[model samples]
Target chain A: MNRVFTWQQVAPDQWRNKISELIDSGFFYFDFLTGVDRENIDGQADCEVVAHLAKPDLSDSRIIFTQVKSELASIADLAPASSWYERECAEMYGITFTGGDTSPLLRHEGLGRPPLRKSAVLAARVLTPWPGGAEPEIREDGRKVGNVSRRRQRPPGVPENWLSP
Target chain B: MKHSFIALIEDKCTSCMLCVRECPAWCINLDSHTVEVTEEGARRPKKVNVLDSFDIDYSLCMYCGVCIDVCPFDALAWDEHRALTSTNREDMILSIADLRPSGSS
Candidate 1:
């Protein structure tokens, strides 16, 4: 199906008002809202909040986005359907939506860093001995080959300091 | 026909770590070492990577078949044979020996 993509960038403080303006302009259908981690990008906000709204007839759609550090104004009051999305964004990216429900969406309360954030380390890669680290010391015939010298490589998402002695 | 699990063709695998890196679930782990092999009539010993170990944690695997598609050597394949099951979470981690097809030694 053909679709129209119209994106608008709004300030963090004007996020809620923009959603209201979109709804008044017949963009009442709320598709989805999500957060994107921008920590790795240069000269950008720590996080970006994006919301997609469409007309009921599926004729046109509008994408509203705003950049925020760790918090932004909540649009759940205007859209109502965005409440769960707001909570998810808060849980995944650690972006707090003021004036909205900031309770735990899928994870337990006070459970370390937000996993979707770029800085969050993959704990599983660190805790478990990676199969890629296998080095056979003894041959099948029972002869010791001794240690082989090679540059150690860290698994993806694991910090260098975590493996440092 | 019912598909069971992913199996590894040990001989064909070069231990490139493509499956481990591309796995979205981060369920695959691999390790390899370099060995200096002196070929006959060659003046210098060439460095070769020896596959040490490869393991796939079934508990975390989503069975997305990413590893099978990314393997350049065509080392990974889908097996119709049933996969191993256990009550313990640790037992779910299948090693290189466990991943091999039943027909191969």
Candidate 2:
């Protein structure tokens, strides 16, 4: 049976070596690489970078994550397959991938804040005052007003009590 | 031609801005303002955005039903025989006051 281990938090400097050792030990496929935002989540670091590696037979796979304070050393050279993924992580999380492509992946102009970061405020979310499922009351004159239930709707993917109301 | 086209029911419209945003040709225009008014028996004034105007430029309309589909309220409809046509291009624009049913506000 293929074995699976819990997510490991490795240091930024050890990222490339550890992944290379795993590749030399039968895991030859580099599946995916991405970043996670955990700024307000309890017992977790602000940012986490993860990579999934698998074997050609697909029987065993390793998922590893590492906490990044601000930036990390890039493993794009070691895992050439993760080049685009690393570029995307750099754009969305504002994390510098040292010695790697710093070009924007999704945001072509690199105009605003990193959208995936918790600190990046969404203008659309702010403009639309009401949450999903709450109907604004319509008046006879065709004007709609916000409901006065005093319950604030949380934005999608945001944890409760993390931001001030 | 002689087929059904778009019609706006002004009274039922809540000025939700759904139709305005969904128009692919950007032919829909709207104007509204929130006003405080006391109802017949209400003790306090209620806030509502009074719809001042809603216009659709049929000259630029591609006849796509995106606006009709996006409206939360059934304020927009398909008028079988009431589609208007004129020689002047300016006559293609229809406003909320012009769309009202006969003899009604």
Best by TM-score: 1
Worst 10 residues of 2 chain B by lDDT: B96-105
For A11-106, candidate 1 gives per-residue lDDT tens digits of: 888888889999999999999999988784456578889999999998999998988888888888899999999999999999988999877878
lDDT scores in order: 0.83, 0.74
Instruction: Point to the candidate with the largest DockQ.
Output: 1
lDDT per residue for candidate 2 within A1-165, as digits (tens), equals 747644666777898888898899988799899999878435545788999998888888889888886688888887899889999998888788898887776687647878889888766544443223233444444545544343655555344554455
Candidate 1 chain A weakest ten by summed lDDT? A133-142
Clashes of 2: 1
Q: iRMS for model 2?
A: 7.9
Question: Which stretches of candidate 2 lie above 4 Å from their native place?
Answer: A1-6, A40-45, A131-165, B1-105
Rate residue B89 of model 1 by lDDT: 87
The DockQ of predicted model 2 stands at 0.05
Error of 2 at B48 (Å): 22
